[model samples]
Target: MAASETPLRLSDRAGAQAFVQNLLAVMSELESALGRESDGVRAGRIAEAMTGAAAKADLAAAYTTGLETAKANAIALARFAPEGLEALKTAQRRFAAVLETNQQVLATARTVSEELIKALAEEVGKAHTPTVYGRPSHSPSPYGRAGANSGPLILSRSL
Candidate 1:
């Protein structure tokens, strides 16, 4: 059989558990960051900041979950493989690669999210800004004072 195909000996259960525990810890951190982001958004100020935080949190959470799943699958392979050692090693490498890919994706997501939020905030601010013929006014409507034209107009006729 090719060396690549040969199975590897399985590591101790304790080692697998340790790896899993580490993955869970990472996941927990990601969750905490996401929670903070949500809270910031709920506060309703500093929208751009909130969006950036939320995006970071989202990407982190996704990466953590993905890496956790990959680790779990690797552990299962270690348990079931007939050629234990080789299979375990292969699984471990595969899981590591997955983790790396997830990290890259997370980073990209964070960047994109931040930019999107900033652009949205800018657009909203522009849309809501008051327009004035003279000095700026805080009135809701730009055209004139509220109820100014509510009364009927009087007309004078000259023969």
Candidate 2:
């Protein structure tokens, strides 16, 4: 495996407890960040949805480090910080729920965007089609024709 996949060294019960505590903290922060991103995207605030990416990336790294330490010293943790282990289990369940919700939201966002783009494309195609009768229908662009092409929309699938 990669260097980052290597388990962290653990010398004692205290180290085990620290690892669990650190993982718990990471989970909490990640949960909050996911909640914000999910809500922001659902509400169409795309910029707000993207504000947590950097924070989530850092938290993910910390989470992995702590989990590596925890998995390597599971026996030691059980012997020393059994209560902390229980807390970590509960936190994991809650985190899992948050992740599920976030996943659903992101999936919905993708579907909505795809459908919207397809519908818009069809409309544009129809507008440009030659007609035997009156003028072809034309809808005013939201950002104006020039402004619409000023930048591309970027959506990241990762949280």
Task: Estimate TM-scores for all models.
Answer: 0.33, 0.76
Q: Model 1 over residues 45-89: C-alpha lDDT tens digits?
A: 335435556556566665555454445566553564435436434
The residue pairs found clashing in candidate 2 are none
Q: Locate the minimum summed-lDDT window of 10 residues in model 2.
A: 146-155
Per-candidate RMSD, Å: 17.5, 7.5
TM-score: model 1 vs. ground truth: 0.33
Clashes of each: 7, 0
User: Residue-wise lDDT of candidate 2 within 1-159, one digit each (tens)?
Assistant: 266665676667787777777788888998999999999999999787888899999887787767767787788778888998899889989988999999999999989989987787666666564544576533458766522332344445553
| Candidate 2: residue 46 lDDT (0-100) | 77
lDDT of each: 0.51, 0.79
